[model samples]
Target: MTPHSSAPDLIPGDLPSRWNASTPTADDVPDLHALRSRHEVAAKGRASAGPEDTRSEVAGDGAAARTHVVVRDADGTARGWATAQDRAAGRVLVAVVVDPDLDDDTGDALAGALFAWAERAGVAQAQARGLAATQLDSGAFEPDARQQRRLEAAGYAHVRTWWQMRRPVTADDEAERPTGPGVRIRAVRRESGGMPDAADLVAVHDVLEQAFADHFNHHEETFDEFLARLRADPGHRWDHWWLAELVDDGAAEPVGALVASASLDDDGRTVGSYVDYLGVLRTARGRGVARSLLDAVLTDAAARGRSGVALEVDADSPTGAASLYRSIGFETSYVTQSWHRDVVVG
Candidate 1:
């Protein structure tokens, strides 16, 4: 959810002649999607990424803050892909994947070379912003030992694990959702220009910024940065934003916010809604603000006949969020681990 930085795409060194690497192109999307999808299916028993997702990652305006490389073998067969997205001022999201069928030695070399290129790309972004160091963050499915080995070999440490959870939605969700007196959720107001009301947008940003402050890996992202990044996503929909407020004594105080995106398959069908961020203020705890915001998302998804709502949650959520999600029917579909490596800009 960030714009492409001024960082130039950096290439890996010492790659064998059999593997050709270059910045990805529109024509390269299908091959890249196939490669990653195969890896995803093998790792998670199903694919979570779509071809559009790969297109955005490698090409298009979505690559504005991203630097990516797609590798083709001697016969011009796509075999690997790597990307480093400038997620924030000093944070880069990195991905390095190879064809699941590659020989052990070939996969190791390819992953290493791609990861090295990503670090260079991250360093380039950091250097452009005049930062000393930037974090290279990436993830792998919990069952993907090969990926874990590559990450550890590339100097990344497994820092955290997350639960990718999803819950089916139906007509009954809206009617059966819980309620809290004096607390209600509403859509972000839009102006005539079709843009969200500035005040409402700021309120949503402020509420989320404050709500996640005490949470793990909380980063201080500016409002402008937040909007630009979210709007850059291909799945972003302005109408999917909402805020929960406590209307007391004729005043509505924002207490929670939820930001979701449309989840699409390779064929571009909206299969579900993915909750990108949902947070409730500390003062609003135990008042069901979090649940209410989720209910809003579920209702929206159900109205459109979306199959389900999916979200990623911290395995050890401090607020007992996991249990609440479980009570709402969310089941862990897969597990992913966050691996991180810090790079110093040259």
Candidate 2:
């Protein structure tokens, strides 16, 4: 890790100067929060995360590492910020926010400094493990043409497209309840303290792994990583989880599982339910497991007064999952583009 003072300091007049990039400390929280707020406001109410998410990203589990950079004006007011996380596959995930009004040069310089930090961090980790590869993953909102161009100019190649879809819940929409033989959908059981049991956690992980095995960019996350990552989200709720079991007298374990979480808007109403993961094992596929699990979630969302359910799907998924979501009444609201750069070791 770089020493706090070793990073370059920037001033307002130095519009294109290098900015200090390092791990976020307690003192940097306020500036990071302010930077996030600026970008969120500029995004016109489309941003999904806030300060809490930033805090959690910095405090990641030991397996992963995070770095946050802040650019400040001469008077010490924050002007830009960036965050990058190192995941298991040697890929560095980056999200950056700069003053939208800044000159193009300033924006480019800020982005350059952040990527430099990521490169250094990746190299350091590889050297420690005697490995030779590091990569980067980034996403740009499709509506932001300027950012999209900037990313491409910086040598990132678009690799995948993600669609954000939503469906509004209605009494009529719930009329077509799912019913099939030997299939049962139930709410995830919660303990007295409101925490889910170990079995529930395992089931959800199994379902997600099996469900996404054939999907685009599908990679198996270790059980520990899955639990840590899910629990890290502030929006995670115990009651919002669900499971699907196949009533097979001969089977020793449940056949399928689905995990859904609800997120509320500022008004405290359950505005949407996000299907975090839904899957059925290979042996259980085509037996109505997926539809039944989805119906269970939809029923719960309608009963809770939620306006709709939302999820992201791979635009090029081989399993035709997008069509399934479309069948369930989800409509494409927006698209996000994923850019990937191969890791180069010096």
lDDT leader: 1
Q: Residue 78 CA error for candidate 2 (Å)?
A: 2.5
How accurate locally is residue 251 in candidate 2, as Cα lDDT from 0 to 100? 56
Off by over 4 Å in 2: 1-6, 9-23, 26-31, 40-45, 59-65, 125-131, 173-176, 191-194, 250-253, 266-270
Top TM-score prediction, candidate number? 1
TM-scores for all candidates: the values are 0.94, 0.84
- Candidate 2 residue-wise lDDT, 53-168, digit = tens: 55656553322455566666544556677666655456667676776666777777766665555556655555554657766777787777666776777678899998988888
**Candidate 1 per-residue lDDT over residues 1-66, each given as its tens digit:** 112222123445566564567777787788888998889887888887888887887776587888
Global lDDT scores for all candidate models: 0.86, 0.69
lDDT value, residue 31 of candidate 1: 82
Candidate 2: C-alpha lDDT? 0.69
- In angstroms, what RMSD does candidate 2 have relative to the true structure? 4.2
